[model samples]
Target: MRTGNTTMRAPGALALAAVGVLVLAGCGAGGNNMTLATGSTGGTYYPLGGEIAQLWSDNIDDVNVSTQATGASVENLRLLDNGENELILAINGVAANAANGESDFADEPLANPDDVTLLGNVYPEVLQIVATEDSGIESVADLKGKRVDMGPPGSGTEVAARQLLESQGWDPESDVEAFNSTFEEATTKLSDGQVDAAVAILAVPAASIEQVATGGTDITMVEIAGEEADQLMEDNPSYSTMEIPEGTYQGQDQPVQTLTNWASLYSTSDLDEEVAHDLVQEMYEGADDIGHDVGDQLDAETATESRGPTDLHPGAERYYEEAGVLD
Candidate 1:
């Protein structure tokens, strides 16, 4: 449906109707403009970033890519570190804490977090946490006092819901009242009871947690495995442990576990390695029109597998070293 625009400034008559759709998409004709950013308009990076910006403007030659929604992985790494986005769709643990400035870019980092690279691995995300089957939460130690939304302010679901509520010692601003919104206003404030839990970090049946598991409000999810998700993957090695299975939502039947990360595809090393190897080879040769299910986890043999702390984008490391899937 191509919807997004769930706020993050806009409104000045939709920012002059997004500057008249970037001057009828010409965006200054021959300059080969690009944008991308994405997130919110109910998650999974704005309809897979509007089908990967219309498959990189119908296959790159004179590029025009646009997309923009915003407030996703730490505001798409400060809009690709202020060059105002040339591509994004982040959350490889908030693009490795905005390239090592660490956790929510520790008080304003990234003015050039070594120009944020990487341009592949677009899947994994997970983390779910939902709640509201009367909010008895059922894990992640029952989300303390509860209200919770925790996403949207420079989200990666608010940097993994404030590091899984400071790895269970609480204090995510007074142990949960928190709201921040989006992910379709935290699934209509957790299906109208007005929040009791939310937390996202998407992909895998998360259309705002499938409208709070079929929208009649009896939701659940929670789980982040034993030993507190292995000490939150030993204190966030950009997190790991995934599962979610059991029918993947719609009152999710069993397999829960949790925590994952990898979303990927960013940009900045001032892009152009033959336009980041034709935007990672037309995003896995037009990953089946990116209709979403995380575009069946795009392939190129796992595209340099799970890249977390960035790097790679010498035009996607010369197209993953000429498609041998790089070493």
Candidate 2:
């Protein structure tokens, strides 16, 4: 992972070894200092977020950038609301939760949920439940009484895991012997016969899942569909249907039907409108710089579809309107 700033000040390396966290420092040459909050290292958010920060630092003058490791959507929203970070990469569903002051923010309601603004949509995040062959789990219902890794603490994965369990009429706290662990750690335990299944909602062909599948371990990617999936989407309007194409993973010859929550960039009202406009404009103009592999997910054509749950920032709206992305 790239760490430290690339401009504004001299770039220096600082690796936080606790959990694959890397902080990138850049010279705040243009006089604007801001931080970008991303997720765990193994997930898609960190890399993409790092690329975004780099683009902004390298292109936008006077904008100094710092990227921070966080617990993905939920944690990033908290940091953004608390004014710790100027920008955040978060899941649409989690962003909705934060905007409504529900779940994690029930007690500590954000002072200005209306101020949460969308920068652009990144891509769909599929909810994957991988069970070891030995666990005898065929469907989500089979998770009963089995030991499961419900993602890391304070993560969007954890929220989605619990929601899926609840939708199936199971008490996640009582029906399953639950443990909290990162996808990396959970993958190791799954291969070692320690955990029966792991609930992870991430970009397709996730590194963690690839780790287990390529290691020759017999694993099954359970599908979450039919009435249950419909109900899940209905309850959380931010969610949408998405499919994993055939051959996306080993032994997975058929497409898997699942629900997806979009990944989006967020900024609060505190950011200057003109600065926000420039940021959004540059993001589209510099799209090619983000690498083909990950950049494919950030299609500028559908960026306007990102306006859900949270309102679009005024500056971003101005740019999108002028560009004809928004009417």
Candidate 3:
């Protein structure tokens, strides 16, 4: 309910926003300009990505850092393929889709594109679905003949929602009406009873879900059930089990089951290995300067586990291997 809020960029803010841009490479080789393609400015990816961009700008004298607003997974990957962005923060499962050119999302059969390289993992994203209690939809299959918003077009949430629905034999176009709107708009529709459900895949304590819960309309989170969940875990190694506790989303006191998404840093092969190495090193070393809450995200322990199935970029591989994260 709180997303899509007006994120005011201060006057001349974009220019001065460079407190974290262009990490000055005082002792080394030439500096390289780097851009991080992050998700909707309204969501977690924006600030988190901004933190990284600033980290590079503030610490590494070898790179000029910038963060571009993007549509989370699908669009970020597209930007990478089109050479629009030098770096991207992708959902692990969605990254697999882009790597393989897998579904209707890409529809046009791609020739196994693989120009992107993985830097490492960032954090975990949960599949958080909010539905009105009045909708009478109790399960994933219950979504049939109902109205659902699958997040925005080209968003990681949209792709994940559709695929999970499809694997369950539900049709996005026919089984349920699908709307491609931001969580803010979708929540309004849901509150108005114009929509039956809305899906958002983000970290917990999500402002959007809190909006739905606190809005006076009763809500429920569905559990991704049975063998399909298992199949998804197997088919997509990046997905892992996550249980949402009751009361976490507006006092709906029952555990909701689902899979979680890992957010990973992906880059185009255009990046030089040494530059990539330095980028990884700087991210880890300068974590503290990015803001404590964000700094915690790049921590040495949990961060490494966030990179799903993608192979770490050779530069990152060297760092991770040396750090005892990889063999």
Best by TM-score: 2
Give per-residue CA lDDT, model 3, range 101-152, as digits (tens). 6773368532335666788777678887788999987777778788998987
- Pairs clashing in candidate 3? 1-208, 20-54, 21-57, 22-57, 23-57, 23-60, 23-61, 24-61, 25-61
Report how far off residue 36 is in candidate 1 (Å).
0.7
Q: Give the alpha carbon lDDT tens digit for every residue of 291-323 in model 2.
A: 625676766677757466688888888988888
Relative to the true structure, candidate 3 reaches a TM of 0.82
Give me the displacement of residue 197 in model 1, in angstroms: 5.8
Off by over 4 Å in 2: 1-30
| Model 3 local distance difference test score | 0.72
Per-candidate alpha-carbon RMSD to the true structure: 17.3, 4.7, 6.5
TM-score of each: 0.33, 0.89, 0.82
Between candidates 2 and 3, the TM-score winner: 2
TM-score order of candidates, top first? 2, 3, 1
Error of 1 at 304 (Å): 2.8
Better model by TM-score, 1 or 3?
Answer: 3
- Better by lDDT, candidate 3 or 2: 2
The local lDDT score (0 to 100) that residue 305 gets in candidate 2 is: 71
In angstroms, give how far residue 267 of model 2 lies from its true place.
Answer: 0.9
